[model samples]
Target chain A: MNIIESITKSDKNISDYKSNLQKISLDKLRVNPIPSSKNEIWRQTNKSKFYRFLDFKFNNDFYYPQIPGNTKNHNICRIIIGENKKIKFKEKKWEIKELEEKEIYNFLEQKIIQSDTTQNWSNLLNHFLTDRKNIIGLNISGKEIPSLEIICNSMTNFLNSKTLLVNIEEETSVSISQINIGDKNSALSISTYFNIGKESVVNHGIISFGNNKSHIINTLNVRQHKNSEYILGSLQYEYDFARLEININQVEGNAKTNIKGIQITKNNEQISTYANISFNGPNGFLDQLNKSLANDKSHSVFEGLIIVPQIAQKTDASQLSRNLLLSNYAKIDTKPQLEIVADDVKCMHGATISQLNEDEVFYMRSRGLTLEEASKLQLRSYYQEIISFLPISKERWDLLALLLKDK
Target chain B: MERKKEIKQPLLEIRDLFASTENLTILKGVNIKINPGEIHAIMGRNGCGKSTLSKIIAGHPSYEITSGQIELCGKDIEPLEPEERAQSGIFLGFQYPIEIPGVSNLEFLRVATNARRKFQKKEELDTFEFEELVKEKLDIVKMDSAFLSRSINQGFSGGEKKRNEILQMALLEPKIAILDETDSGLDIDALRIVASGIKKIANKNSGIILITHYQRLLDEIKPDFVHVMADGKIIKTGDSNLALELEKNGYDWTDEFINKK
Candidate 1:
């Protein structure tokens, strides 16, 4: 099936509710099932939002974004591309290509690999499983570069592809940051995949900005080997309905994973993120910190769970979700869960949701600071907590700080 | 805006000022006034409106002014926000100062001083100049210069924090200074240092309104006038000798003396 025919079929055959033993791809639609009135997740969350997103359509065309310019002098490479699908990254090569026919069919055939929750498995596959045909493999073997920068161009037209692969060399290391930028007001859909090698380290950062009235759904699938380290960082701004789906598979023991995410939304925007980390190997460690800021009637939802299998012992993992509600109407749904089958495992989870500090506000204002000045100062201080964790040079840090000034 | 038209009225005027927090009316139609070139001592009982009055004049949102007016230099300042009133030259030396973590004292002082300077459209001190200015002010407060490197009021002792609060007031140079129980948590030595610092920094251009529950501070920092506050109102005003009389006789001293006068 082609892209248009496939999308048309997906738009047609999607049922309100699935009855019997649902197909793996169809399980993605398990988001809002019937007796939905009794859904616990929807008790505090507005259930109508799922239906509102059903009417969103994708825009067709590819607009590769240019790197944000730095007014200050810096030594970083500039990866600039035009308003076309063609992208040229001079830093390093980690490009996505069309997947083989067999590879595409195999992934689509087994779209649903069941374990614990089938909440998003069926629907995601039923709609997205078939059309995936893109493949990006990581080749960090022979030649080494300073850094591996993957500049992904935006989609003017919606296309569903599958099986993007990344293979890192054994004992080799590289850092990749995909800067996603598009028009200020548009809808977008994208998928990404990663495959790690043994004894290698991977540093990946996904930064995206979607305009108002826009929607983004990104999926990341990773497979880690023994002694490999993976750090996944994501930052999103704007985007009315922004969603990120992260699936981490620890295929080997002694591997480590760290996932850090930060999102800032305004203007009645809604963002829901679902991330899952599974352990297939023992002695694995996972650390994650997710923070969201909601202002101007915006809403943010962070639903994440860490699953440790019975055999996956000696695993040390933690997840934290923090949110700041900037306005009275702004809302946050932050829940972090730890599901461990092993009794001896070391795992913990916690979350915090709050507004700006009143005493701090008063302290700042008492010093002749205005409300806006005080709030900005507090915001800068708040972001500093995470910015301190970023592994960028002072120059890059300053540049990012200036970009987030108005933010 | 600061540095605007000359304001030559009494530095502060609290006229029939009735204030409350929650349902408790702390200031029941109290009135007091102070002009430049003079220090006024307001000695009151523990539950009197001394601190509440200080917070009200500072425009603390928690305190409500039911039916009264407070004017600064003849202009009604009751309508302004706390920060606006602060920028308009009103300072409150809190007895129980707050410790705000993460904000360095230097950064806080610079931001505060620059805010006032911004309001006044006066030349602001650059980094180098600000360091010198802060150093001088720290000495004026008799505080160690290392305090500037610490967070605002964080981990500071009672005396150090109070001295820092006074340091901020001196740096801001508000027209009216209300020291609310400032000497409550200080030792004899700390009190002497703090009282002398206040006396040294406050010029005749600024009116010092000192509120204390004890007459000890009044003795150390001699005032031109002493007012005895009772039931949220000042019922007696006399020369500095009134503080000595009240010190020797307690509340009944002012009560009997006022009843006779």
Candidate 2:
């Protein structure tokens, strides 16, 4: 109770934006863990030990994660030593800054926040506004962002307090890979707002492997102009628990979005992901796949919802989650749901959980491999399912491979 | 730490072995014996219990050995698990090798070698030493080093997958190797390399049980003992000439021999 209320306490002046956030207290919502006999999300969730643990809203102090045994080789962002620590970006035409409250309000008034309801999770995000005005935002539209690298270097109090937002202008194509690193047990509530112009494309890459209890809640609000495209790659491998909520809406016809993500969980760690995509126009498409491997007592959860409105004709959406449970006790909860009111829309979803085949093991042993070796071999193959589909980068693939598998 | 037992005893012995699946018998009252420094070939048409007999010896759980006595090096081994028998040097080259999509070939090799080595109370190889050890075995199957990093058979061709089986055989160096139809789908190049690799590893301290449907592989490995099997039992036993005759006259000769009996 102390952990989570502390999160909501960061906000004080909520009456100003009460109209934006639904007229319901998030803490008081009748979601899971509440004293309700019926639970929607837990209908299929194996909630024996997790029911009690899920109520843990937010704790003020989570022990600083032991610097991961070896991260000397992880391929994340780099940190510079000086004061004007020049931030590096894979894409140009963007600038970073810790703006004052006035600057933040000015940007908001200019329609820089493209998201509608996805960014409304915090009833009062401005309440915890310390570096609330800090972020790298794009100015001009119709320009292409090669591959932006947003560098986040923290001081001692990095997560004790701070928040930031990244906004992309309309009609611009920007690609960014944010690297978050430093000492504090940082809890970052990140929100992204992207606007798509006619026939424009935006590809965003996220490679997070830093060692810290990073509480990152990402909200992506996208508007698809006619014939526009949006592609996103989400990469996460290290954390006690990383929760990412992605919300997308296709506003016009002939637009599409392809989203792919890979996550690796080990130890007694946990990872939670929520993706809600809706098509509001005709002739829009969504193709998404998310893969994860949870070993030891590590737990993984993925909930994907692809909604096609009644007027959203000719929409195509497909989603799949493939999980490999390395240990008998390790658990993966995957739910791919399609809520469609349009008869002409094509939407499908599936989830599968299986252990390595016994016949395959014997076949490997026949080649002189021991049972343990056979298991390792099968595990390597499981992780390769995602790495093989990665966008052709040898260094990233090698680094991810090492982080994914211990042996 | 590599213990060497006495070589005078039978390397493998299966007596009155009746193996089954779902309580129905597939290997009925079969008996076979193989000693060190010898090569035995089992010839039969499809569905003759050739693969079943090999799986039974390797401890495949699906095929239950209802009533039998199997001895390896003069000790009863029917009760041991598949992994236990592997440590004791019983290898089964499968007809269709399974693809393990997540494991790298090199990691698989090191784990297997170390498991057997651990059984023999030997030290396991470190990464550097393991790399060197794997380099030599790469030549055994004429495979490239690039395969070491790739996932095991995730996207390998049929031929490459089979060659991988041979590569593993050369690396582990088991004492009793059972090649179960290793030549079933290989072209001439793969078949020649696989046959040569098996022959090179066949020394006086080891033995091989070559199970095949045709005499094509017999021409390469040159088996010393040829046994014809039908209806889950070996009907006749002879020298290498039996394989040539069976290749020419086919299984009809076996029917004539059975009628004469």
Per-candidate TM-score against the hidden true structure: 0.77, 0.71
Question: Compared with the real two-chain complex, what DockQ does model 2 have?
Answer: 0.39
Residue B71's lDDT within candidate 1 is 91
What CAPRI-style quality would you assign to candidate 1?
A: acceptable
DockQ metric, candidate 1: 0.39
Q: What lDDT tens digits, residue by residue, belong to model 1 across residues B1-261?
A: 012224467888888988888888888888887887678888878776677778888888888999978998889998888888888888888878878765678877888887787777888888789888888888877888889987779999999988998899878888888888889989999998889888877786788889887877987888888888877778889989988887777786545644675
lDDT of 2 by residue, A1-407 (tens): 43234334434634533322211233222131132324333333334323322323322232333232243554443322112334434435543333344554565443323322223432123222222223334332445433444444333333322233444445566555554443334444344556566766666655555454443434455566777788877666665655556778787767888888777777766776778888888988888988888888988888898888887899988999987777888889998899988899788899988776888877666544667766766666665555554432555346445753555
At residue A160, give the lDDT of candidate 1: 25
Docking class of 2: acceptable
Fraction of the real A/B interface contacts present in each candidate?
0.41, 0.53
Q: Native contacts retained by model 2, as a fraction? A: 0.53
